[model samples]
Target: MTKSARADMITVLAMQWNHRKVENLHKTLSMRFVKTTQKAQTEVDNLESLKQELNISLEDTEQWVLEVKQWAATDSNQTRHRKRRRLTELKKKLRERILQYNTIDTCTETIDTEAACSLSEDVILPWEAQGDMVNLRTKRRLFDQVMLVRRMEEEKVIIVKEMTQHCQNLRQALEKLDHLLHQTKDDIRNQSMFHKY
Candidate 1:
């Protein structure tokens, strides 16, 4: 082969080798990222499971508290006994709920760590000159998605708050009705007693 041609061939070979090395490096990095992403996903699942359990516990506690309060206010032959029983049960349930909340908080800490790691995983390096524009675009897209998610979460919170308020109003109305009924009964009993005398 001519000297110039041989030199050209050597140059091409070096370029090919460099390209292969870059490709292999990218592959290695990609595999590592996938593993990290999977770990993050597992953490997310765990967090969700804990959150669901917490919600169930919260609902149960709320119902139990309501029942306890109702029993406390009830005027009946066994009111004292029922109130004591309810208070004892509520105390036990409250302790259990506190334990569950502690567990959930621990899980949340783990989730927060995992989330931080996951978010950092996709972060662009300042020195990444070639892909800065593309990275910026990607960040913008992710920001939009995050904003959308926040809006949805806010809407759900509003709905939940409205429902809770409505429930409270309903409970108050029922309590008022019960009070009026009790007053009427007492008034009738007093009148009957007076007439008998």
Candidate 2:
């Protein structure tokens, strides 16, 4: 081959080699860019999914809050009614006790005698024995009155215990409501911050 032809051949080969290197670099950069775009799209999809999850959580929390409110109100009303009924029953029992005690006292007063019977009276009359029996019945009634009062007191204590338990349940429900509200608020705040980004 001629020297100039050889030089031309060398120049052509060099240009071809440089073109191949540029093509390889372009392919590598293009592949990297495509991979980066796919990764970004996946990240965006994950963010959307997170937002959807947060929305569902918020909705469920809201429903729970409403349910709790309804229950609290209903329970509160029921407790109030129960307490009032117990008080009324207790008052009636107290009045009954007072009436019975007064009756017993009156009978005792009538039975009291300042003077002893005359020695000529060898035995009590049958009607007087019946009166003594009636007095014994009054005393039994007085004993029943005390028992009733004690039973009423026990019932009052039971009512207090039940009321306290109900109040504690109410407090617990309120605490759950507060916790849910706080969690929802925090979720909303996080969502807002994510959107800002």
Candidate 3:
């Protein structure tokens, strides 16, 4: 073959080899770009999922706080009503005791000195026996009720404090999340505006 023809053939072969290398490089770069893009997209999706999870958790916590408040309020009202009723019953008992005392006083005034002297210290009056029994029972009942109410109030106070603290923490977390969301929205808006300009 002529030298000119041989040189031209070599140049053509080199050009073909360079073109193959460029094509391979382009394909590799394109694949890498696609893989990177998909990885970034997955990361974004994960972040979105995490945000949703956080939101759901906050909502559930807030709901629990609300339910606890409702329960506390209901229990408190019921306790108040029971206390009122107990007070009213005690008042009634007091009135009955006063009437019994007055009746006994009248009876004693009419009692002869001989009969009064015959009744020894061991010979208890019927009214005294009945009043003592009733008073003892009422006293025991009142003591038990008072203790129960005190315990319940203590529990209520503890629950209220815990709930208040939990609610406050939840509120702060929600506020922070809201603020972050707003900042993200503003950044996105600014980026869009920047792109437009």
Best candidate (score: lDDT): 3
Model 3 scores a C-alpha lDDT of: 0.57
Model 2 TM-score, all chains together: 0.32
Candidate lDDT (C-alpha), each: 0.56, 0.55, 0.57
Q: Give a tens-digit lDDT track for model 3, residues 1-197.
A: 99999999999999999878654654554555565556555654554464364344445434544554464566677798997888667656655654565567445533233333343444344456665232333233333433444455555555556556656766897999999999999999999999999
lDDT tens digits, residues 1-197, model 1?
99999999999999999878654654554555565556555654554454364353445434544554454467576887887788767656655654554477444422232322233545433234355233334334333433444555555555556556656766897999999999999999999999999
Residue 118 displacement in candidate 2 (angstroms): 30
The runs of at least 3 residues in candidate 2 whose Cα sits more than 4 Å from the true structure, single-residue gaps closed, are 1-136
Of candidates 3 and 2, the better by lDDT: 3
Query: What pairs collide in candidate 1?
Result: none
Name the TM-score of candidate 3: 0.27
**lDDT score, candidate 2, position 54:** 39
The local lDDT score (0 to 100) that residue 176 gets in candidate 3 is 100
Worst 10 residues of 2 by lDDT: 111-120
Candidate 2 Cα lDDT to native: 0.55
